[model samples]
Every structure is written in structure tokens, then in C-alpha cells.
Target: MSRLYGDPIEVWTRDGEPSQFVWRDRLYLVRRVLDHWVVAREWWKVREGDPGERQFWRVEASPGREAGSYELRFDTASGGWLLMRAWD
Candidate 1:
């Protein structure tokens, strides 16, 4: 089964795409982007200054050994990145 992290992460990007990230004290290079999507909540459903839109990228990443699938998120309201999920 897949796991959800929701942990804050530091990400590096190239041409507006995620290229690498540091999570839990380990660095991982994004090998391939498996999918990309966006989640946007209705305007009336969110509070002011807390817009409800997030960009998500599902990618294959590796630190050195076999790669793992990771889901990254960018919250528009806070401009912060998070490791949303992972699959081993």
C-alpha cells in the first residue's frame, strides 16, 4: 500500500519543474515525472489569504539505490512544498 507523508520538503526545480528534493535528511533526484495535476478548492470554501489551490507532481526519484515513486505538492497559498506521498 502507498503511504501519505504530508511532510515539508525542500525542492529544487528547473524550468519550473521539480528536479530534486530533500526529505527527512536525504536528497533525492527526480528521475522521471509520472504525472502532474492540480487541486483547487472552491473560492467560497476557503478563508481569505488561504487560497485553496495546490500543484502536484508524481515522480520517480532515487537517492542512490532503486527508485521510489513520490508525490510532491506546492501549496499556492503558502508557496511551500511538501512530500505528499510515497510508494516503495
Candidate 2:
């Protein structure tokens, strides 16, 4: 278990894949890999074209630190997942 922004967060993996996590009444995927792990928050952002903003984390499980991830921007206006790169 870890705490972020004063919120209690619990993380567990199954077969190295980010299987379960909870934050602010929301469920997240924390995928774990041989080289790294990932955390994703599918949130709605904007109202029209973009869904708005999302939170993502690329974790380096080997080194035990965040490897940097990205915020997914959904164009609610466009009604689709932005085809942008993870780091873009």
C-alpha cells in the first residue's frame, strides 16, 4: 500500500500485470512487466472534443521508482481516445 496526495492507495499485481488498484473510488490498472510497470486512469476531460485529462504512471519496478508516464487527453469534442503517444 502507498499513499499519494494524502489518499490511501493499494496496489496488487497478478502474474506481474497491474491487476488491481483503487483511488478516490476509482479502479485503476497497474500493469507490471519485466522491464517496467504501468498505471492508468481513464478519466473524462473536456466536454466536446476531448474527454479532458487523464493520469498515467510508468513505474520501474526493478529500480523501485516512477519512470514517468503521461496524461491522456480525450477530446470529448471529438469523442475518442486521443491517438497521441504516451509521452506526447
Candidate 3:
């Protein structure tokens, strides 16, 4: 798994699910959504003014070639997205 810490991205969602994303100037289309879940921040661990409630989608995506699995995250607090991790 390759970690992409807080890398901002642009996502296209369909029916509230992430269908594709633009990252690092490339577009990756999601082929399959393997899993989905939500992670609520622990109040004790959260600092003041920090974002919380991350929604994660584990999916198989392709950039016009062989598909790869990746974990994409949506920060509910900030309404932003991130490419969290990838399995090549």
C-alpha cells in the first residue's frame, strides 16, 4: 500500500458514490467499489478546529490501463477529498 497523505483531489460522484477522481493531473475511473465505511474521529484524539468524520471507499480504478485498488477518503467536515492509499 502506497500512502498519499492528504493529497487533495477532485472527485466525480454518482449517486453519492465516488465514480472517478483527478489526481496529480491524471484521471482515474473507478471500476469497482470493494468496500465503503465511515470513521468518526475520537473526540479525545481530535484537536480543536480539526476536521472529522471521514468516509472511505476502497475501489478498483484504472487510468486507461491495468486496474489498481485504491482507498479514497472524503472528509465530511471540510467537504474535501483525498486519495488515501493505493495497491499497485
lDDT for position 71 in model 3: 89
lDDT of 2 at 29: 53
lDDT of each: 0.93, 0.36, 0.88
Off-target runs (Cα >4 Å) in candidate 2 are: 1-6, 31-88
| Best TM-score among the predictions, by candidate number | 1
Best by lDDT: 1
Cα-based lDDT at residue 33, candidate 3: 98
lDDT of 2 at 74: 27
Write the residue-wise lDDT of candidate 1 on 2-46 in tens digits.
999899999999988899999999999999999999889787876
Question: How much does candidate 3 score in TM-score?
Answer: 0.84
Q: Residues 1-88, candidate 3: write the lDDT tens digits.
A: 5756668889999999999999889999999899999998888866577757899999999889899988899987788999888887
TM-score of each: 0.88, 0.28, 0.84
Candidate 2 RMSD computed on C-alpha atoms after optimal superposition onto the true structure: 13.7
* Clashes within 3 Å, all models in order: 0, 20, 0
Regions of model 1 farther than 4 Å from truth: 45-52
